[model samples]
Target chain A: MKTLIIIRERDYVWLRTVFPDIHPLLFPICNKPFIEFLIDFSILSGSEAVRIVSDGSLIDVEEYCDNGSLWGTAISYSSIMSMDDQRAVIEKNRRFCSEEKILIISGLVFIQYDKLHDYKSLFASQPNGDLLVCNGGSLSLTGNPPKLQKNSAPLSLSLIALDSLDGYYRLCMEILGFASSPYVLPGYNNEAYCHIGRNVVISKSAEIRKPVMIGNNVQILEDSIIGPGSVIGSNVIIDRKSTVTESIVLANTYIGEQLEVQNKIAAGNMLIEPEGGICITMDDPHLLTGIKKSGSVRSLLRFLVHSFAALLLITLQLIPFLILSPILTIQGKWKKSKNIYYTGTAGETLTLTTTTIERRGFISSLAAALSLDRFTLLFSVLRGRLAVIGSSLELASDSNTTLHEVESWYHAGVFSYAEAEEWPVSGGDKAIVERYFSVHGNPFLDITMTIKAFFNRIHETNTP
Target chain B: MIFHVDGSTGKKLGIAALNGRLDAKNSSELLTSFERWQQQTNLIILDCSKLDLIDSSGLGAVVSCLRKAIEKNGDLKLANLSPKVAMVFELTKAKKLFSIFTDTGSALQSF
Candidate 1:
């Protein structure tokens, strides 16, 4: 049977106020996006194809679910008018709903179903009409109903309207309190009620009381207490001495040291008292802030180390640069151009004279191998303007130049870590390699990377 | 910040109504005015019903006012803390230090 899941904008408008960044359908319930539960139910009920119809933007959901190949089902997306009713949606998707029993699940509602039960046969046997519904939404059958044997027992089905924060919180708590066997919850559940995800670093001094679900890349710091009833999302850090009980700490949130978070929903810097729906965006970074990599001290140290390295390199390469640069220029092997390039800071540009060396003859190849082409840019390091080894030089006028996720930590340099690692010096993955070293590489490591990059540049046969 | 002496409960109480934001920009002003208000009466109630926002500096200034009041053997209480301001107090664990009330009348009567 085919399924059409219609989610109206008004049904999930409240979620926008709480989670501004997340789409309503992508809102996590028990560390799982709400739409995934619906998809799971459709798959269990023997849906060969599923189409998610929404009046709201389905970009995130589409990106996440894709063609539903992950779930072993064909999934499609369609747009609908805000005023579109059930019949209107069915009529719009007439081609998809043709020649089959279509299961219509509408609105922002939770379906309570167990995977152990054979819902496929039960749903196929049930008569077409409204099967189960709640205040917020309904589960109905449209098109044709399949004929079945008379011995089929009534399928246990129920719906809960997730229209308010209180209801949403209560539903999550209920699902969490119960063993997560009913729904497919993300994370590894080695023990009952304790589900953990990848790269979870729980400190030796920290306490983990059961009935908790933690997501990927979570750090429960020293003396931190997690659980009794807690759902921590991905990339969350519970700082030292912080106690999280009966709380849902969303992804990318940093719980401050010594803070007691009880019966709250923390999403980044905003903390919400779910029962009262009271929310407060914290202004202080120390208390309940977003977990972001801000390496000011490391950046300063890198600047000092790079400057010292640049000063040393300049001294050693001075005579070779002075002799080879003029000779290369006179030989028409060195091509120079003054252009603007993008700096680390947004909207900031740097004017630098870039030289391209044509490695045609012995003198030019010697100059290229000696890295005299990047000789003048060494001053930028001494001036504290660039790193010795960082991201690839991005041109300011290049409209196609977009920053990758890792490139946000990018510090443009004369030499890149990608060049040091012998990875592709330009492209998407190059930014990732550079960013990895930028975050992990210290001043000493940077010096080593710079040396490696310098030697690696000796073997370069391609034009810059 | 508007300060007035209230003796409705037959005891001298300084009621300071804080309006708008109490951040780094005007936190020192509150601290300076708090010293002058403390001279009139030590038992003070900070009415924060109109307080929309408060940063760390503002919280520090309020704590300092409480410290000065305690040095004079008096108490500084908070009243009608908005949810936003209360969240700051809770996050910083400053709520434990002050006796918070829902209204100014109750804060005054408690003294």
Candidate 2:
């Protein structure tokens, strides 16, 4: 059987106010995207193929789910108009729904189903029409219904409309209160009502009362209390003396020292009271704040370290650069170009003379091996404008000046983390590598990466 | 901010109605005004029914006011806290520092 999941934008309008960045379909319910649960149900109902139809932009959902090979199901995506009804959806996907019984799950609804039950047979036996529905959405079947054996037990199915924050919070808490066995919740569960992910660091003085679910890379500080009922997402830090009970702390949030977080949903710096549907974006860092990558002290220390390293490199390479550049330029082996590249800050650009050395003779090869091509950019490190090891230099132009890309800590550098890691120095994966190191790497680690990058550049046959 | 005396409590109860946003920009102003209000009456109730938003600095100022009230052998209670402002207090654990009431009458009576 095949499944078509139609999620209209209007259905999940309320969720946008709470989680603006996330698509409603991709909104996580217990660290798993809502669409994943629907996909799991579709697959369990014996669906060989699944297509997610949406009126809103499905770029994020498409990037995440992508053909659904990870779940062992062929997943596809299609666009629909906001006015498209159930009939229009089926009419549009006529080719897909032609040869088999098509299960049409529409709206922003949560289907409650037990994995232990034989839902495949139950769905096959049930007649086509609206099986279950709530205020926000419905679960209906279209096309043909498979024949079933006589005297089969009725399929037990229920739906919850996720229209408000209260509904969303209740759904999560309800799922968490019970054991996560009914749904495929993320993380490992050794015992009942407790699921934990990897790299969780709990302080010796901290206390954890069970009936809780914690995701990866979590740090519970000294005297902190977690649980009784809590769903802490990945990369969260509950600071010293903080107590988290009956709360859902989302990913990349830092609960400050001596804070009481009870019955709340905290995403980044935004603290939300699910019951009252009140959300406040905190302004103070000490109380509740987002765990961002950049820090003032860290940036200052990085600049000092990079400047010292650049000074040393300049001293060592000064004589070689002086001797080689004159000879190479005289011989037409060294090409120089004046170009303007983007600096670390927005609306800022740096004018620099870039050199491309032709590795033809022994002297030119020595120049290339010594990385004299990037010698001029080392001055940028001393000026505190660039890092010794960071992201590749992006030219200052309309195409390259993407505000989102430039806003990150991926500052222009003479030596890049991608070069050190031997990843592609350009394109999407390179941005990921650079961003990862920019967030995780310290000044001391950057020194090591710089050395690795310098050595890696020595072996390169082409110009950077 | 508007201050008025509550005669129903049969005590020198001061009810201060706070409206609009309380942030770093106006938190110090509130703190300065709170000192003058403290001189009128030791017992006070901060009615936050019209308060739409609050940040950490505003929370700090309120905590400071509570501290001053305690120093003067009196009390500072919160009343009619809007959900949004109440969320800030709860998140910062400032709600535990004061006697919070659902309405100004209750807070004045508690004096």
Candidate 3:
């Protein structure tokens, strides 16, 4: 049997609104990513291959679950339009679903099944129909059973709808409360109801209760109470005297000293009460904050490389800007406007003098080609106020929206990643492209993107 | 901020409607203004319906106001806290220090 998992964007939109940084498929459940559990189940249910299709961007998930070598299953990913029905989805992957019996898992759901169950034989005997059903999703089989050896037995499987934060919290707590967990969870489990990961430094003074799962590279500081029920993700630090019962501390988070963190989801600086789905991004670092992995030796090297590139561009553009800017000004072709934009710092704005060099005569086209309009911004790049290639500047008028969006690796730049890709400047896709490059970009890619952006600007200016 | 007296409940309840943000830039203003509002009637209702955001300092100012009201034998209550702002209070454990209501009218009645 082969498996096809089709999760639509609408099914996981709530996860996007709450946890924007994490893909819904990669959202952790019982210390394992939600997708991994599904994969594990698929492996058990006599599946040799699995295909995951979604309407949203699956690049991150693809990066994570690449070719499914870890599971020893051939896994592939595809994108579908939001309006596509199950029939359309099946039709799209006709070749994969044609030869063998297909086990279709639709929507955002968690399947509850025992690891010890003989699911391979169970699936072979089951008829071509929905094996398990819920409001959120269904597990349906297509094509014929493996053989006609008449078999009748009750199937022990249920679907848990991960529709709301409350549902998610309940599901996690239930998994933790189980005497023996149904699914294979990560970390080292020496005893029941307790799992700890690598490089975990637990203070001798700290008290750890039963029913807890701690991820890799975590530090439980002095006098801390870790659990009666708690799930701590990788690179987390539970500070001194803090009580963390019935809570989940997501990866790369710092819980401050003497704080009570009962029954909440702490992701970075955000503290969310899962029951009510209310969340807050704390500004004060002393209380709760993200332990960012940037500012490393690599980033410092990238900054130096960017500064060198900026200095070269300044040297190249200084002459053209001096020669043509005055000529354009004389002919009233150079238009200048002062706009306030959000700076790198929170609650700070920088006044930038933007220019529009109108195309008219030879000098005008020359000025646009040489990118004299961006001459002043190069200095800002050198001064470390902006990057050579990063996100497009967000206006101060839009600071309210920027305040929310600027949380994840946002930095203003002279040239945007959107320009390198030649995407339309005004759309959601542009932000995606810019953010992708900002987080994933290195000095080498930045140089290539900078060159691409420069020539793209020239091509755009010289179009008409 | 708009300060008014609601006496329909047979008590002088000062209702102050906070607007925009209450961060470090403007938190001190709230603290300075609360002193005058307390002189009129210490039993005050901070209507946070229009308020959008608050930082740690802003939270400090509100807590300070509550303390000042308690010292004067009067009480300060918060009402209509937006979910965003209320989450900050919940995270900081400051929710236990205030009598919070769902609406300004309920806060007035409580006073």
Candidate 4:
């Protein structure tokens, strides 16, 4: 048997809105990406090959699953259009679906099946048709069964569409609530209702109330309570005195000290009450923030390199700044404004004396070209308030938007990586560029990018 | 934020209706408004039906208002909290501090 998993974008549009960064197939359910479950089920059904078709960009999914060697299943990915019907999808991949009996799992639906059960025989015995149908999608079989068993017990399986946040939350809780989960969950499980993954540091004073699934590199701090029912994803920190009961904390999220996080889904700095469908992007880092992996050794080196680079830039531009500043101020060409900007740390803000030069002449242009406008900000680098090259900083203003939303990779930088990459300064484009640098950055690479940014500013076309 | 005194309960009870959001921007405004409402009636019930969202600062402001009401030898209660706003209260453990009711009518009677 072969499997064809058709995941239309329209089926999981809500997931894109809620988790824009995550691929629909890679959306984590109980700390394991959603795609893994489909692969497992496809393998369980005695499938020799699996082809996943999606309308959206499958680059992330392809990159993650990568030939399906991890699961030892021969998995292939294909693209389909929104208008494409089930027949069209099958026709498009007819070569792959030609020989074998095809098991078609369409839409974003969860298959409730016990791993302990034998599905191969049941699938072989069943007639070629849809096994079950749900509101979101269906599980149908194509091609004739080689030899049907005379009398086969009914397929004890159910399908549920993960359409809404409430449905998704309920599904996770339902799985956890099970005395023995039908689906295979990640992490190490020795006891019932408890799964702890690698490098989990649970403090002596911390309390574990059971029915908890903790992922890799978690730190349950002193006096913290984890789970009565909870899922803590990889690289999570439950700070001292914080209680996470009936909640889902996604990977790389920091739950700040003395906070009570009950009945919610925390992804990085954003908190969502799934039952109510209320999502809150927290501005205060002291409450909740994203934890980027920067070792103390790496951070110290970065700080030193940034400080040194800042000093070099200041020394090089000091003469030009002094020569042009007085003339610009006299000509009323230099405009200074005090704006509050978020610092490198989450929730911390710093006031910068920002200067904008009205470039009508050589002196002003020279000042701008030498990047004199950023001179005041250079001092902040030495003080460890800003990055040498990081995310583009936005003003923390009291605007109409309650979404004081900053991405997890956000860091106020002396020079934005977007400028260095010569990328457009729009929010979406800037985020993509900055996110790349945030992950791929090293102390040495930062200095090179800083130089590129400085040169890039010289070519910056002034409106005046 | 709008404050109203419910006289139907045969006691002095203030009902404050919070609007759209009570975040960092307008949290202090809620605190200031709550102070004035306290002078009229120490028994207060925050009607949060229309309050769609709140942040840490806003949660702090509400907690502070409850503290002030207690210091004045009276009590503050919560009523008609929307599910979204209620999640914040539950997450922060602030629900434990206040006597919550289904509606302002019930909250006023409780006072």
The share of true interface contacts that also appear in candidate 1 amounts to: 0.50
lDDT of 1: 0.87
DockQ of each: 0.53, 0.59, 0.37, 0.44
TM-score per candidate: 0.70, 0.70, 0.78, 0.72
Q: Which wins on TM-score, candidate 3 or candidate 4?
A: 3
**Residue A420's C-alpha lDDT in candidate 4?**
91
Name the better of 1 and 4 by TM-score: 4
Clashes of each: 0, 0, 0, 0
The model with the greater TM-score, 1 or 3, is 3
Please give the distance, in angstroms, between residue A133's alpha carbon in candidate 3 and its true position after superposition: 0.1
Compared with the true structure, what per-residue lDDT tens digits does model 2 show for residues A166-250? 8888888899987477888888888888889999999999998878899988999999999878989888999999999989998
- Candidate 3 residue runs with Cα over 4 Å from true position: A149-151, A199-204, A280-286, A289-302, A319-335, A340-351, A358-369, A383-442, A445-464, B1-111
TM match of model 3 to true structure: 0.78
Model 4, B15-52: lDDT tens digits are 88988988899999988898889879998888888888
Per-residue lDDT for A85 in model 1? 89
Q: Residue by residue across A1-464, what tens digits does model 4's lDDT show?
A: 99999999899889879887688789888888999988999888989888999887786787788888999888899999999999999999989889788999999999988787888888888787778899999999897665855345678889999999889888887787673377788999999999899999999999998889999999999999998899999999999999999988999999988889988899888889888788877777878888986568988998999999999998998888888888999999899999888775345678988888888888888888888988888999999999878877678766712232424457779889999998987668987898788867888999999999999988887611
Error of 2 at B9 (Å): 4.9
Misplaced by over 4 Å in model 1 are A149-152, A292-464
Each model's lDDT comes to 0.87, 0.86, 0.87, 0.85
- Per-candidate RMSD vs. true structure? 9.0, 8.5, 5.2, 6.3
- Give the least accurate 10-residue stretch of model 2 chain B, judged by summed lDDT: B83-92
